[model samples]
Target: MGPLQIKELLQQTPDGQSVTLKGWVRTKRESKNAIFIALNDGSTIHNIQAVAAPGQFSAELLLTVTTGSCLKITGQLVESQGSGQAVEVKIDDIFVYGTADVDSYPLQPKRHSLEFLREIAHLRPRTNTFSAILRIRHALAFAVHKYYNDRGFFYLHTPIITASDAEGAGEMFRVTTLDLDKLPRTDEGAINFKEDFFGREANLTVSGQLEGELGAMALSKIYTFGPTFRAENSNTTRHLAEFWMIEPEMAFFELEDNMDLAEDFIKTVITYALENCKDDLAFLENRLADEDKNKPQNERSIPLLEKLNFVVENAFERLTYTEAIDILLKSKPHKEKKFQYPVGWGIDLSSEHERYLVEKHFKKPVILTNYPREIKSFYMKLDDDGKTVRAMDVLFPGIGEIIGGSQREDNYEKLLERVHEVGIDPETIWWYLETRKFGTAPHSGFGLGFERLVLFVTGMGNIRDVIPFPRYPKSAEF
Candidate 1:
């Protein structure tokens, strides 16, 4: 057989079986009798011990096995005498694929801060915390596809570059190939986009929900999983310039159906991580607990595993936007002037308001619905009072709005009026507007920020820590 991965070797019975393992050396210690090495293959957080006896290899070979050294070894898997590990490899042959220069190696055996690791992102995955996070991220992604596929939702690939401003936020990154120093000008002295690559204004898509809806109109249910970009200038821990979004749109589905699916989908993904990523989650949980030791008692978050399980077991509390506003009006934070941004019926809920709803007031996940139309997008179904829309936001304890969706307006006239109200040119989104003109049904969908979900599940603080290569305001370092 080919070389066995460390994860597979660790699970098998160590009955003196010969195996070839390929991985990097995590650490090396020499005893009086033998040389002990902790080797990892990036398949699991745990490392397998490989012992090289005194005569098994030359002194030169032993000197090369340092931290970050790549190696290929053929050895016998035997029961380990070590305390933490179950199996050990008694080396027979060794090949030093690469050697790390101890003087310049960024990742040492000692603990490095997350900020320091971010600078060397190319090598950070070799660390325990990042490796575990990436593994759990993989598990969560798999569960997302599995859950949607099991429910018969067709996966749709939407265009990355689009001409329409779906969010109407106008924060899209433009996709163009034009020389700024010498640009084509129109008769009005304005730079002409007609000479550009796409022959018109185009941008990296901000959301796929608009296109996903077209697929749902025909397929009954469809979803999009891909990268989206934003040109916002915020440099907070919660913001990312580029990120992945999962949007599932369904035809003939109302706001209630959307909320139900969102809740169930989140629970299913979290449960998958709990089951398949037990070792990784356990490692992260311990890592988080260790991190909380320095924090003040009141500032420490709930235990990692307990928080995840609590979300899975409990039903999310549902309330209207008006009710939430009423609750906030009477809240101590509101009366004591603790919120930096004031809260009211017409104003959009800030992070403080959302956190209060989920963490302080309800002490659980919150599903807030019926937001004022002025505060929501133009596509949401307007209520009879014409003041609120059928929009809903799923708020978590630490992460405020993990998911936002609503039942789409099926009336062409009403939707058109909303489009005009939002100052979007009707000619630009004619295709999207046409969906309502033909056979429009009451439909709904929601967007789940994949990294934010990973952040919540892994109990990571910064959104950048959860993603592999984060693209933020002024940084795109890999």
Candidate 2:
């Protein structure tokens, strides 16, 4: 009764004993003499069984209760009936805290499509699939803080509004309160938002790498975990208008150091999740997949411990970007063979190329390094050849690029020239340049797409499902 989790009840010494529980009704079924209720409290993925008998309860009354209504129950926990359920409870008391209109509420007895679930973001969290995801998300986020703080990396917060384009993607969501109807124009035809948006052209931050670097120079190691925005109109299972990113910056580090940190960071997270949220992972593996849908409880496709087994037992592959390109070019798959933009030494890789390099060529999570200078961000350190950038992108088999990072260009003069060459005003970045002016080191860092990593671990198809409120184009429904 004192804030008990469902998993504690399932794996505890409470069977056939009276217990108190509270949750929304996932489903309820009624026969002539009794009523059966499937209830979950978001404490765990498994629903506990509640049975109300004929004399103390009416089947007709139980059937009247809506699926999503909030309720409390005092009952005797019992072993599962012969078929169609797990652990069950014999009801002694039932109190309806809040009533839900069955017809109006979106969720029904039958399954709803993920697309249908996306339209009602607020209600989706109550469903089994979404509830499991949010729990995993909580566990995963906790693992991130634990991973970095244990390594003595300061948790830094960068500004949400910025003048710098950290990704150089030019797809920023403009942070403006100006009236475009009466805009101020310069001497030339180009209109100036400097007098408009926050007295300067400002937009939401795409990455925290720049500010994170400043912290690294001071603290030796630092990481920024926060929301990042992009205005790119990419409609895919992978892209989102807003997402969470974990960017780590380190001093006296190089490309190899960055790779080692990322690899260990991933392994640490997987280990933590398995230890913390075993039941949710098991629910996903056993109950969610269709192939194992009909399999018995012992033979379910999903298992909480198997994900850790997969990540820890198998070594992730590492290859240079050049080698990845070669793999993609030689891939026998039709999509890889007929890429729209032909692959060459200097060309940046397409998502298709990246997926093939990981899923088909290497058949595991792969790290690709040393990209072309013309294709990557300007802040990346120029490799020795002067044509390639000392950058890396960690590509997973299902998700293309889960992270992108590099050793920064710490040369003050070269950094300034890079700013100018990239057509950005040097005045705005004077503070950033001051790091190189005072003290600079050979630092390296990378930004991991947090949701994409979740998708990989859970085998969830869409990026929208992993995030609670997936903000995409033309859809902001709560």
- Best candidate according to lDDT: 1
Q: Write the per-residue lDDT of candidate 2 for residues 1-478, one digit (tens) a residue.
A: 3756666677665457878878889888767777778888988887887888766766455655669988888888787764755667788998888878987988877778998988888889898888888999999999999999999999999999998888777899988887778778888967687687477889999998899999999999999999999898888988899999999999999989998898889888978887787767877675456645676876543343554465556677888778877766666764446766677677778787887776556666778888887888889998878878889887765457888888889899888888888887778778889999997888999999899878867768789899988888876766
Worst 10 residues of 2 by lDDT: 299-308
lDDT of 1 by residue, 78-171 (tens): 9998799899999889899999988888888999999998888899999999999999999999999999999999999999999988899999
Question: Which ranges of candidate 2 are over 4 A from the true structure?
Answer: 15-18, 58-64, 79-87, 180-197, 286-288, 291-310, 331-341
TM-score for each predicted model, relative to the true structure: 0.98, 0.90
Candidate 1 overall Cα lDDT vs. reference? 0.93
Clashes of 2: 4
* Cα lDDT for residue 68, candidate 1: 96
Q: Choose the strongest candidate by TM-score.
A: 1
